[model samples]
Every structure is written in C-alpha cells, then in structure tokens.
Target chain A: MQMTKQEYSKLVDKKSPPSKKLKNCIFAFLIGGAICTLGQLLMLLYEKAGLSETQVKMAVPVTLIFLACVATGFKVFDSIALIAGAGTLVPITGFANAVLSPAIEFKSEGHVMGIGAKMFSIAGPVLVFGLTAGVVYGLVLSIFRLF
Target chain B: MPQRTGHTLMLPSKPSVTGYAAVVGKKEGEGPLAQWFDKINEDTTVGESSWEKAESALVRDALALALDKSNNPPSAIDYLFAGDLLNQCTGTAFGLRDYNIPYVGMYGACSTMALTLAQAAIYVDSGAAQKCAAATSSHFCSAERQFRQPLEYGGQRPPTSQWTVTGAGAAIVENAGPGPYISAVTLGKMVDYGIKDANNMGAAMAPAAADTIKTYFEDTNTSPNDYDLILTGDLARIGSDLLYELLGRENINIRDKHNDCGLMIFDLKKQKVNAGASGCGCAATVLCSYVFEQLRQRSLRNILFCATGALMSTTTSQQGESIPSVAHLLNITI
Candidate 1:
C-alpha cells in the first residue's frame, strides 16, 4: 500500500505477458508488403486501361479504400490488420477503417448523432492540424508570390 | 472463521439468489456456454429498430424471464438494481422503465454485476428489501462505437484487446428462498497502475482484481483451497495470467482454483477473440448461466465471484489519462 510509484509501475509492467515481437515484425512486414504489392497491381491495371495518369493515381487509393471497406464489412480486416499493423494503418485504407468501424458500430444511435457526430472522432484531430498546416503553407506561398 | 472478516459484510440473515436469467446475442449464443443461457436470440434487434432499443429489449426480456423462472411477479419485487455499458446508463433506464419497480441505476462498467449483487445482499440482509433483482447488460455494437472503433471498420485489434460481449443477465435475491445464499461480500477499491492504453483493458483491471482478491482472502481468513472456485470478471487470458502472477508474488496461490468469466463464456480458439470476452455482460452472462447452473446442481459450493470494471471514458482516453479500475466480490454458497 505504501509502495513508491516506480515500484508500483514495475509491478504493473511485469503483468503484461511477453509478446512475440520478432515474429510480429516479420508478419507486419510481409503482410504490409503484400498489401502494397496489391496496390501496385491495381495501379498498373488502371494505368494499362488507357486512363490518364491523374485518373490512375486517383483510382488506386479509391480502389484500396473501397476494398478496405468491403473487407471490414466482411470482418476480415482485423486479421490482416493484426499482422500488418502500420502496413495497413499507415495507408489510406487505415483511415477508411478508422472512420467506417465506428460509424457502422453506432448506426443504432441514428445517422446524425452517431455517424455524423462520431465520423471524425478518430481522425478529426489529425484533420484539424493537417488542414491548419495546409492553410498556413498556402498563405505563406501566396505571400511569397506577392512579394 | 467468523463471518465478520476484514473489509467484508457478513450477512447473518441468510439472503438467497432465488432466480436468475441470461439473454445473449448471436455471437454469444454460439459460444461455449450456449446451452446454459436462458435465451439465445440470433436477431439482436429483439423486435426493435435501433441497437440501443435492442439493448433495452435484451434487459427487459431478461428481467421478465428471470421473474417467470422464479415464479415471482414483477409487482412482488421490492427493488431493482441494474446498469449497462452505455452513456448515462440509459440502457438500464430505458429497459427497466416498464418494470415499474423502485430502481437503483448503477455504473461500474463491467463490474456492475458483482457490485449489484453485493449491494443487493446488503439490502436483503438488513430486511430493507424482501426481494430485489440485479441486472447488467452490454451490447457489442453499442460498446464498440462508444469506446473503441466502428463496427464495419477494418481496423486491426491489438494483441491485448478484448471482444465486448453482447449480452445481458439478471438475478433475483430474496430474504427466503431455496437457492444459493449470499454468505459474504468484499468490496473493491479503485486502483490505477498508470496504464494509459485503452485497448489493453485486462491489464488496467487486473491490479484492482488482485487487490480485491487478496483483501477477500485476508478478511475471510480463507485461501484458494477454501472455496470451490475463485472467479474474476472479464480479465480474459492476459488479465487472468497477470492476476495469477500477482497473487503468486503475494504468496497466495489461486492458480489452482481460479477462473475468469471472460475466458469461461467463449471458446477463445474458435471465437478468435484477441484476448478474450469483456464488457459488463461478460460476468453477468457467465454468472447467471453457467455459474448459477453449477451452483443449482450442488456441484459447486462456496464460490467467490468478483466482477471487475475499467473506469475510463472516451474523454479520459483522449486526454491521455490512465484507466482507473475496481473489482467487487461476493461469497455465494449452495
């Protein structure tokens, strides 16, 4: 009861079972690479379809996001995400999942309150700072051009 | 050992668990304790349009089933103690509204089940309430959207994360009944071990569970061998192991007689639940179904049921704060 913070922390720290980091890293790398490779294949397919470069670039992420949403609806994304972690999370699909998961879960709360309000709960902070930075950079560029 | 042990209330009046009910959704129905549950509905909608309403329905039907099983009318009950994994405990508020009984809405997160049992025992013991019902519920859809991720999102679960059980359970305690009686109770204290990650709830709750278990043993002058089983609520695989280690360090071995509600209700291998099942209903469904059955058949006697809860909200998690948790215990004898 009188234990110091360090002692209490040490005790709590030891409570978590040891995880297989090396094995996990390998899985993350392999799965992440596989997803990226699939993305590349999609990009190639779109490019070979006589689409413009801009269209192909846009189609790749949109396709991936669509696929991620589909996989999530099927409940198969968690297994893949489990292995690839950042490989899935660092990509656009991760953001899609971040939005989609909570939205569908709270669909019972109604669209406006549940989906609309919480749609950005996960990614809102990132969006806020990202948009702010973009506006600041745009202003700086415009100021330089004026000078 | 005398009934009045350390930090525990000894009920000399002999209150009993007269009736109980368990209602679970599809996934829980497919779990290991499928047959033990009183009602298993594939349609989680429960004739309702919304998930929140469906959750309310789950509790209402569970309380009704329990009263029917006990052959007691709703009007006969004196008090109703209930809670759920919902904002403002609205799940219980809306669900039990039609019951028309004096209600005490509580929120102990996952630990609400045992907390209710302990509180009910106190009332029944002192002759304040002749018959009282305690219920707790959790819906997978409701809890996920509120606490974690969206249901349809392809987000990966951390190795330490647990599945929130979609279920509800209710129990009736009476002053005179032919059932398992409440012998004692050991209340838990809030314990924070500085764990900030919300995904690893088992770790956050294990310390409180350990403290409560140790205190119960010390107070009752009993050990692992004294009871047929020592059950902890919703700790699952990781938290259960942590509890084992912590108790071992304290030199009180419970590994032999210890079990967890999270691990009991589901087959981890088949369910693919990362750590195990959690939520307020985790302990409720297990206790009302499986544990109650065993106690009914006289196969188990002098069992300890301790439900644990994580006291953290989305607001706290966003602010980068540690999860504070508590565990409440009940000593039941058949």
Candidate 2:
C-alpha cells in the first residue's frame, strides 16, 4: 500500500508545517536563473574576444561544451541541476554541455569508437539541423542575390 | 513473435461502462511488508543480491495475479513489455522469462510502467494484437545494490535522497475487454536540471511530469478537473510539490486530486522512508493495488496515471551532470 504526503498530512492533520513547496520553487528559480546568467556572461566573453558574429556563434557552443566537460569531469553539473530544474536545460549551453559531457566520460572505453563517436551522440541533431538550415539559407540567398 | 494480420478491432468501450482490474503482492497478515525496502538503512544486514531476488519474487506474484484476473493465458499474450532499475533489466527479464511470453525490453527509469502500459494499450487498440501485457518491476535492494552499493555498505544519503521501493507490478490490456480501457497517452518532454546527484531522482523527474501533464491537457482538451485522480509515478514528496507549483503556474490546479505513489506507500514516521521511493515498481504496484481497485468498484470514473523517469547513465552521473527525465501518461477510462 503506497502512501503519499497528502495522505500522511491528512492522517496526522498537522497544519502549519514547513512548506517544502516554496523552498523547492525558489531553489529551482534562483539556480536556473544563475545558469542562464552564466551563459550570458559567456556570450559577452565571446564578443570581447574580438570574434565576428559567425565566429562568436561557433565559439559560444565550443565554450559551452568545454565548460560542460569540465563541470562533468568535476562532477558538479547534476547537483546544481537538481536545484535549478529546467533552468539548466533551456539554454543553448545545455545542448552543448550534454554533448561534450558524454564524450569525456566515455573516453575511458576507447578513442575512435568511444570518445570520437559518443561525443557527437547528443549533438547529432544539432548538426543535422544546422546543415539543413545552412543549405536552405544559402539557396534563398543565391536566389535573392543577398550573398 | 506471433504476427497476425487482420482488420483493426476497435472496442466501443465507454468510460462509464468499463470494469477495471487490480493485483497486490504482500500476503494477508503481512502488514506493511510490501514496502519494507524503503525502511532499509545502509547498515542493514540484508545483502543487496538477496533483496533483488525478494523484489523479483514480489513482482512475479503480482503479475501472475493481474494475468489471472484478466483471464488471459500467458501464451495468448503477444508481448511482455517491461523494465526496471537494475542494469540490463535483471528483474523484469528474470521474473517474467519463465512464463515463455515474448519480451520487449524497455528502459525509461521509474516511468517505465506507464510507458509500457500506454504502448500495450496502443497495440490492443490498433488491433496489432488481441492481448498484450504491459508490465514493469522494481526493487530497492536490487537497484541500490546495482546502482550504488549494498545496503550494509553504509553511506550517507544526501538531502536530495529518494528511497527506492522493493516491489513489482503488472497490468494486462486486451482488445476485447469489457472493462477499463486506455483512452489516450501522452509522452513526456525531455527536461534536464543541472543537478548531478544520483540520489535525488524525484527532483529530476518533476519537469518531465510538468511537461507531460501540460501536454496532456493541451492535446486532449481535458482539464485536471475531468479526472478523478491525476497520479504521478514516483515524484515522492519534493517532486510532487514541485509538480504542483509548476502546474499551478499554468492555471492547472491539481492539488486536490493529485498524489504521488512514492509518498503514499508507507508510514513515514514508523517506517521512516527517507525522502521517498520512486521507481518503476512504485507506480506499477500502486495502480494495480489501489487505483485499479477503485476503478473496479466504480468509486472512480477516470484516472490519468503519469509515470515519470530520469534517463541518466552512471557515466553521466559520475561526470557531475544533471539528469534528463521523461514522463508518460496513461488515461484509464472505467
């Protein structure tokens, strides 16, 4: 017989208890916002590095992957994520972080099949989309004489 | 694999006229034993391997009860769709293999039960098979032994801890049922929180539940008020509250009808289930014993059981990465 907190709460009828609800929400909000802010900071760094718009876009993902790899190596990302909720996942940083994290951890198995292949596991969709979008953009530019 | 090609069979099962089924494992006079694993501490003498076997035994019995009540021969079932917390699906495969039913192994963490049930219902509804049994099993001892270490290997559980339940549950869905039928299902969105601790799966699964619940309402055009109960697999105490807050933001007030199986299964004071148990078996056993029984008695008209899972790997966990979660919704009309 599985029981829930609500049922337990009802059984005891203990009102005016510490609110676990508020704590979790605030915890998720603050940490999640912090992660996004960090991404913004990275973006600023990319611009200050004197990179062009295209280069900055590319570098941002690279930086995210690197940061995620380091975080994963240090084993800190998941702990922070437990508090932040979706705040860690919504940004482009999350995608890059996911891709690189797996590659670095799997490196122990082998290089060719392990690090090389697994690193792109999560990023495969991004590459497909980027290539498809690039081709579409190129075709449109050629037709419109924009590039 | 028995592949039968024929016309689609749509059972005109109304939500109001369908009967339901249920099964529980703990024998009579064995009070509160079904969830004994939640109370197990790091210093317990029980070996992890033994716990795994015990968990498997419970699940096997529960599954047999569900199958017996459904009145379907084990051989007539098309596939045994199942999963568990153990590496390589040890409990599900071992507990059910002897029945000689074709197995379609799946892994979606704790949310596996609803995912399997939803898929099983689809097979029956689409005329893919006359009967398909979708079942999942989980054991805290087995999970702890495999994922972490033996219970006797005392270790401090962090604040984000969620106790794994030692239990197993199964459900049978048939095409010619004159009972509760699965109406629709909603798969959860993959959501990640940068929390790297493997101890707290409940928190990891919250966003997945929020995503699926929101999607279910949007897709089905059904509000939380429409169902008698809106249950989540193993969100436990913390995750359940998290889900409530998330849903509240969307103006989907489900506090009154919503519940978590992890939190509901034991006496927290006497048993002292730290955090709460969230696994494949948690929700499976609850649905089979509590929810389905209510449906059979016509005490509840409709139910939306949303099982949630954290799709994380040991490598990902050791790498200090956040967990990605998925949730699946099974709408049962009685």
State the fnat of model 2: 0.00
The most accurate candidate by TM-score is 1
Each candidate structure's TM-score, on Cα atoms with residue i matched to residue i, is 0.90, 0.62
- Model 1 clash pairs? A101-B150, A101-B151, A101-B153, A102-B150, A105-B151
Each model's lDDT comes to 0.86, 0.66
- TM-score of candidate 1 on Cα atoms, chains taken together: 0.90
lDDT of 2 by residue, B272-297 (tens): 45667667877876776667766777
Candidate 2 reaches a DockQ of: 0.02
Per-residue lDDT of model 1, residues A1-147, tens digit only: 334446655765665545667876787788778888999999899989988999999999999999888988788886788767777887788888887777776666688997888788777877899899999999999999997
- Give every prediction's interface RMSD: 3.3, 14.3
The regions of model 2 sitting more than 4 angstroms off are A1-147, B1-49
Give candidate 1 regions above 4 Å deviation.
Answer: A1-5, A18-35, A38-48, A69-84, A132-147, B1-5
User: Tens digits of per-residue lDDT for model 1 on B1-334?
Assistant: 2156678888887688999999999999999899999999888777788778888888898899989888899999999999998999999999999888999999999999999888888888988889999999999877876787666655556678889888899999999898789889888999998878888898889889989988988887889898999999999988888787667778888888989999988888798888899998899999998998899999998899999999999999989999999999999998
User: What lDDT does model 2 reach?
Assistant: 0.66
